[model samples]
Target: MVLGVLGALLVPSLSSPASAAGDATVVVRGTDLPVGGPIELSYVGCARLYERTAEVPQPFVGLGPDQAPAGERSLRYDLAGGTALGSLSYARSMASTTTSGLSVQAPRGAAGVAWVGYQEPADFGTTTYWFGRADVSAPAGAWTSVETTGLTYTWSRYDMATRRAVGGATAAPSTLAAMIAERGDGPGFRTVGFGCDGNRFALDALRVGDATGTTTYDLEGLTTTTVMAARPAPRGTVLTGVLRDGSGEQVVRGTLVLERQVAGGWETVQVVPAEAVDATVTVAPEQTTTYRWRFADRPLAEGSVSEPTTVTVAPGQETSQEPTQQPTRQPAQR
Candidate 1:
């Protein structure tokens, strides 16, 4: 009989899937999005994962400008180890002001919010040029997660050419609920998004709702790659594996299961904790056996498995190698 002493397996996790540049824009209906357009929209840049803040450690988008001079009129989001992308835009019916909120991490002076749509009884005719600077700030070194439907902002009549308020700002800040009620039966939102030229900030878990239901958009997606290797050692065999994200960065934390092939199907050999990026095991197998590593599905990351690894042993070689550590046999679990 032989025992395998395995080290804890360490693998990181992502919040959700990612939407990269050049990919098809994502769209959702019943939310009053633009006709035949994306639910997640960006012009100066695209949306990508950002992990600089503890409050928003998930795959959130960081909005800012590209390589432009200060005060340049740009809408962008900066991606880690990548170029600056554009601001984010979502289609929503301003008419439905049931509830709305978003998680934001911003620095001082970050112009992190906006709303563009229609307004009635305006000096300027109804050309759908209503822009509100919802510049909500966050506490120092913290992220803000607050309901916004009842929040207030002083809207200004927008000018298409200047992309700024045309006339004096409204008398006082008005809540979305009030704005919707005042608009009456006017056309709702043309587009709602985040970005003030030259102001860099981060956002996550954006939520909006109407009479129907609420929808939270978190940019939601990511892909993973895992690999396994087997080599001859003083013991019978040494098995090792690692898991990584799409950018080839090693995953930070998770549990990986060591699986072995049996007559019925693959069976669990042991549970490996990912305290580190790599997982290793020393096994003195009686015969040649095939093994692999598996990561189960998590809240933010998808499930994945490593390529199969095979360890070959000669008849007398299995028990001949000296042991490096005391072998603690772990009972296989289903």
Candidate 2:
């Protein structure tokens, strides 16, 4: 449970409930210089188990950021880590893409997967990023921009600005280009990776670009906003997520939403139960209240607004309402 690039879970993971089989991972280490082309990866696991790992997968050939890179590569699908605080995403080529099940809903259930990885075609070969886990090369931090609306998908954690994509089904953009060649290893060829490469995120396969759009890519509402942390819940305690569609599968009741950060800012109220790939949401914060959790209103993207979750309700419970000073209308001093 001790894994880090910057503080990796120190106990936390309880405020009430919402972490069932919460095995998470998002890897991508380094390398790709002087190779060929085509190798992408993307992280943030479990988005309904990456549409159940491709419903019609199998395809190849597109390498050649020049040559030395190669072609015909495809390991494909895996991603499920939604309930965001950070998930920046990059990649627009082909092969490997996972974010399995995308299950997120913590208020006190705590959280996991606050990822970062970058490799912008530093030559070619090495490229990685994972979901259930696998893929490597590229880790320095800095780069964020997104959009994949329907359920949600918006980000800006890396700070580079631009985040929007919670869900947009229709999928086939090769699972968002294998979720940015695993996780931001840009270029326009094909060689995405994980596993043997030590790409960090411990995923399986996230292959990108599949092409199959008649009209369905509606992953909800996609969004990406940054802040970090959110752990202060009580009440009925439910804040879960897990959706799948556009070729991958698993959608069930599908509707998801929790987006709460109350008072000082951010609020989407609640309307959850996208169907539960492992979902829950019934938080109870009364006093000092402050929240940062996502999958907001459900569609797909819910990337930032954690690191400030501060619910505190007990001893009788039910009193959180104070903070309604919007009056001051005594004009004219004449």
Candidate 3:
């Protein structure tokens, strides 16, 4: 079934985190955190029964806990790990045990993956787990994996911005790099973790890393029409327009380019920062002109031009002529 494939791809047997190319990897070893550390864990729906531990559960080995994959400590989750269905409660109950200081930058052709090792007893039944960037939403049944009575490592590659899977689950490093070159350009920090529907599980050795590649997201139809504030105005009028992305969502950051229809072609007039929903600029054109806005090209989004708008400038007022001379002559005669 597609669900089974997705689960197998999203969740693999425990393995070591992939190494970063040129020191670009960020890792969070479970043993590094203090025991009984304060963490924020939330359960899906209204079910709020869960617990966590940061110690080696030697006694729980019979119940499916395993030694830390890389260090002296491993994070343990018990009580209701596999009780919930993957379709209803996948990662709905999870925690942010530590801060991942991974900074994703836009316009930089970058791609990365998050990996974690977990151990579950054979009796835990079918439980799903996932680790990736925080904002990522794994498809229902994507993270389901049947945990055997031992430790295994699983990893999921993400496009970074959309957090969608890059290639299939358990994608090879080269495949991940190529996928990044094709689509993983949006920027965001990475995260890793394990989750279950009420089965006991232990997780350790979280890691994220990136590589450089020339790839950009296709945002061809993601742009909306440019909305101008005023159509006809004086030569020295301020022209304003709002720039949005492929989904018609206003871009709050980055650069919006203003272009004018010149004698032969379109010429860029100004490159303004997208600081708000709308961007404004003063234009004193010598004649009527056609103008448009576009986003500066970035890794995650391609540069797109908005619909052009023509602004009509009123002609200069005609100078008053002979009336002044006639009035002066009449005054002299009086």
Ten contiguous residues with the weakest lDDT in model 3: 325-334
Candidate that beats the other on TM-score, 2 or 3, i.e. the better one? 3
Better of 1 and 3 by TM-score: 1
Stretches > 4 Å off in candidate 1:
1-92, 105-116, 119-128, 140-144, 161-164, 167-172, 187-203, 218-287, 293-303, 314-334
Q: Indicate the residue-level lDDT of 54 in model 3.
A: 29
lDDT of 3 by residue, 234-274 (tens): 43446576766644666545466677787888767776665
Candidate 2 vs. true structure, TM-score = 0.18
Cα lDDT listed for each candidate: 0.45, 0.28, 0.33
Model 2 stretches astray by more than 4 angstroms: 1-237, 248-259, 267-276, 287-334
- What TM-score against the true fold does each predicted structure earn? 0.45, 0.18, 0.32
**Positional deviation of residue 111's Cα in model 3 after best superposition, in angstroms:** 15
Clashes of each: 22, 157, 18
Output the worst ten-in-a-row residue range by lDDT, candidate 2: 1-10
Q: Which digits, one per residue and each the tens of the lDDT, describe model 2 over residues 1-334?
A: 1111111211121111111233322122111111111122232232221222222212111111122111211111222323121122233432222221221111112223323322235423332222222222223221111212111222221211222222331222233345554555432221222212212121212212223211111112223333332333433343334444433444434443445565576655454443455334445546545544343322132223334445566677665342222212221111
Best by TM-score: 1
